[model samples]
Target: MSFNVALSGLNAAQKDLDVTSNNIANVNTTGFKESRAEFVDVYAASLLSSSKTKVGDGVLTAEVAQQFSQGSIKFTNNSLDLAITGNGFFATVPELNSLETSYTRAGQFKLNQDNFIVNSQGGHLLGFPVNADGTSASVSLSTAEPIRIPTASGAPQKSSEVDIRMNLPAGDSFISSAPGNFDPEDPLTFNHSTSVTIFDSLGDSHIMTYYFIKDDPSVNPNEWMLFASVDGKPIDLEDPAGGGTNPVGGNISGPLSTGGGLTGARLVFDSSGDFQSQIPTAANGGIITSDFSNHLPNGADTSQTIQIDFNLDPLGPNPNEPTQFASNFEVTSLQQDGLAVGRLTGIDIGTDGLVRATYSNGTSEPLSRIAMVNFANEQGLKQVGNTAWKESITSGEALAGEGGSGTFGTINSSALEQSNVNLTSELIDLISAQRNFQANSRALEVDNQLNQTILQIR
Candidate 1:
């Protein structure tokens, strides 16, 4: 019995040492959780005729339980590197991968060749796919598996509203004939032609500049004629070139916040490539009209935004919509050319886990959402090596939500999750386990010597 007890002590100590060694070995492993091997007492019953108190037993090896504490996050410059700040596992639905379904806190991720978000091993991060409009990619996660994101945006887009600034010379006044036409008594009426160019889906730019020419008050004052021009030709703005009709006929739409409208619009073009505009020319000799506007209005100038919307009823084989990106996403921008512009300038996930982008036009969009996943029974998880873990039946179903929602933490971009194992703690455990194992071996050797002596004496 004593020998058995000593052997059990040895076994337990060995196991404890093994556990500690593992912790120390994985000290730098991302998403790795430290562990400790438990020990239990083994006992034999000394039974008398009527026994109440039981004799104590020796020791036995027990299960190696894991410590599921959060690891410190290390910030890396890689946008693909993810970290779990709080409690939550990154939702991954692997395809053609080893684990059919699993969960993990190891946020070491990267962009695959296909632009699909994936683990270093090419296992993809499963999520709802985003459309061209950047909306919810998934309506149902059941039958429809998480989709892979492609590398490229579907197609480049054309801007809807362009800023046209033609100096009024501070002394010019106009009077027109129509109801919404320029009234000689009103300072709100337009006098010059304002044109803008819009690019198509194929990146072919069309010069659809508007002509804000007020029917030459000296000529037809009753009909504040509205004409549209394309590539320097006097186009019947009411009739766009190639096919579609023009949006601005007489008066441009009013601003949303305040009821302010711009009228006396004309589109003129000289298809002969001999287009000259004295009124619409910029101080730099460049056209004062642009397809996209960058606003930088200092002070309380009440920066304005003109929302010009157009549909994609193209002339040729093209299927797209007329859209524009403005202000750092969600916020609106002014009409000025350049100032404090933060248009989506290459969207990258922020340290806080927010997905935003930047544009040359000084606008951005809310792209993807990042969230960490935590496990109720992290010990119940199956290790997939490479600092990754998979959910097991014991780890319970995962809870999915956005960062900063529920018990999740905010995603800090360009950061990484460091390993949680402490080297010092592991080393201590290893020494303790090693000492116990050594003591147990000594005890066994002493017992063997005593048995030999007793046998010789007998």
Candidate 2:
């Protein structure tokens, strides 16, 4: 009995040493959790034995339980590296379409050949589908899929509208040439000129120049004539107030004949330099509409029409309209509603695990939301290799949710979670286990000497 007790003590002390050594060895490992060895005294007695005289047996190894505490975060330069500040695990699968899942805290992730995010072991990281506004469609683990980034260029959009605000010089001289003669090549034909780049349906850019010709003040006071040309070809502006019909408080002659004719839109201002009205009004809120189909580049959309908005708002108290001020000509604002084909620039991941992709066209699109999972019993998880775990009977079912929601933690991009093991505590435990082993060895030696003495007495 004494020999059996001494042997049990030796085994318990060895188990303690093994557990402490493992904690110390993995102190620097990423996402590693430390474990502790537990023991209980082994004692057995029959009902006839007196309780007061009973002596306890040696210690027995119970279990080596893992401690799933929070690990420190270490930042890195890679944007794909992730770390959880609180509770949650990143769910992954061995294959792209595999449903068999494993949970891990190790966030060393990179893009594979197919642009799918994967870890060092080639496990595909799972993410939930997201809407266009960056909201998750579903948070269930079953609906999660492997995230893939598209390498294609962003879609192109044709120019539909243009908002321009400018101050025309009130003291500028009229055109030296004929009243309706506006030439893009000759500076004397127009008072001032400004050019803007506009996009076609095929993502091609073209220069659209606006020529401002101060009309003969003797004929039309406080009035200016605006002519537009695309690629140096004249484009005709549609008469919004119907053909041959002039607007109120405006001096506009009958519509000019089409087919290579030099026509212009009339801009009328009040005495105080405030924009009162414009010719070709009554349509599109007094803005001029021009169809560039006749002068568009080959293979471009011929039906695309651009509306030039002078920011005229009669309802608002302080409308952002173009002004004919005494100051020099200055354009306060100019913007076009068009986009060219965009190439992939970079990627960003937010705290809520939302992944967004940026493009060269100044546009960003939401790709996916990372899937996070938590178990009811983290300690009961069966440890797999590579600091990963599998669900077992002791561990409850995995509860899936988005990061920074519910009991889950926020995700930190470009960071990693270091091991939670404490080296100083592990070293102290190593010394204690060594002493326990030595004491058990001394007990065994004493037991052997007692046996030798008994044999000598015989």
Candidate 3:
């Protein structure tokens, strides 16, 4: 009986040592939770025996319980590395086709060869699908999928419309009215010039230059002649070369007579510097139309018409409307509706767990949202190695939710959760376990000596 009690004590001490050693060993492991050894005293008893002086047999190992307390967060350089600030675990999958889901606190993630975010063990980080508005498609854990980042955003889009808002110097010198018309080759003909890059159907870029020439002040004080060109080629206006719709037969002079030369509209400003009226051979609400289909490059669509809008409504936003200020000609704002194939530039995670991807085209798109899961009893989860756990009967079904919602924790991107193990406490526990083991061994030695003495007496 004594030997059995001593042996049990020895086993309990060894179990305590094992638990403490494990805690110390994983002190630096990311998201590692420390465990504790629980024990209870064993006593000999009968079915209905009432004994006030009952003696205990020995210590028995009850359970090895894990401590799931929050660990300190450390920020890292990688944006994919994540850390949970409160409660909940990151849901993951071991493979693409795996049906079972694993929960983990470790968030040391990186992009795999295929650009899927995964852990070092190749386990994919699961996330909920997101809509275009950055909302999660579903909150169920079963619906979570591996996160994959798209390298490129579809195809290129051709420029169809352009919006321009600028100030034309109202005090510039006037040019010769009749003989000195707007010319792209002669700088003296135009007072100010600005250019904007426009894309074609094939993503080829072409510079569209706008030239403004102040008219003779004596004849038209509030009038300014405009000239449009593309890559130095004149853009033909709907109005003929002469004043109105009539096409003057005589050949024009200077650059206006060139092959690509095109007549432009005239801008008139009120005395208060506000826009008054603009006259062109053909225009719709102050918007000039150009057919780039004739100048399409590299098999691009030649029938594409580009709308140039000088939305200079006096009632429009002050910054978006053109002003005839006595200042240098400046383009306040120039916007276009075309972009080339976009390359992935950066990725970010929001407090709501929405993963956003930014492209070189100055656009952002929602990729996927990180999925968080909570259990009724975290201690009931069965450890599956690699700082992860598997669902068990004791652990109730995983409650799936987005980060920062309900009892779930907010995800800190570009960070990692350190191990919960306390090295100082583990070292103290180690020493205590060693003393307990020594005491148990001393008891066993005494029992052996007593047996030897009894045999000698016999």
Best prediction by lDDT: 2
TM-score of candidate 1 relative to the true fold: 0.63
The Cα local distance difference test for each model comes to 0.51, 0.84, 0.81
TM-score of each: 0.63, 0.92, 0.90
Tens digits of per-residue lDDT for model 2, 1-458: 78778888999999999999999989988889899998989888898998898988878888899998999999999999999989999999999879889999999999999999999999999999999999999999999999888888988788887788898999988764634445577787678888788889988887888878776788787888877778877776666555523454333332222323554577878778888776766366644545766877578888887778886766532447888889999988788988888899988999999999999988889999999999999989999889899999898999999999999999999999999998988999999999999999998999999989989994
Which 10 residues in a row give candidate 2 its minimum summed lDDT? 251-260
What is the full ranking by TM-score, best candidate first? 2, 3, 1
Model 2 RMSD in Å is: 2.7
Tens digits of per-residue lDDT, candidate 1, 167-197, equal: 2221233443332443323325444445455
lDDT of 3 by residue, 266-370 (tens): 777877677766665334565454566567657988777666676756463355667788888888888888876677889998877899998876778898999
Off by over 4 Å in 3: 177-180, 236-255, 259-261, 280-286, 314-317
The lDDT of model 3 is: 0.81
lDDT of 2 at 341: 83
What is the alpha-carbon lDDT of model 2 when measured against the actual structure? 0.84
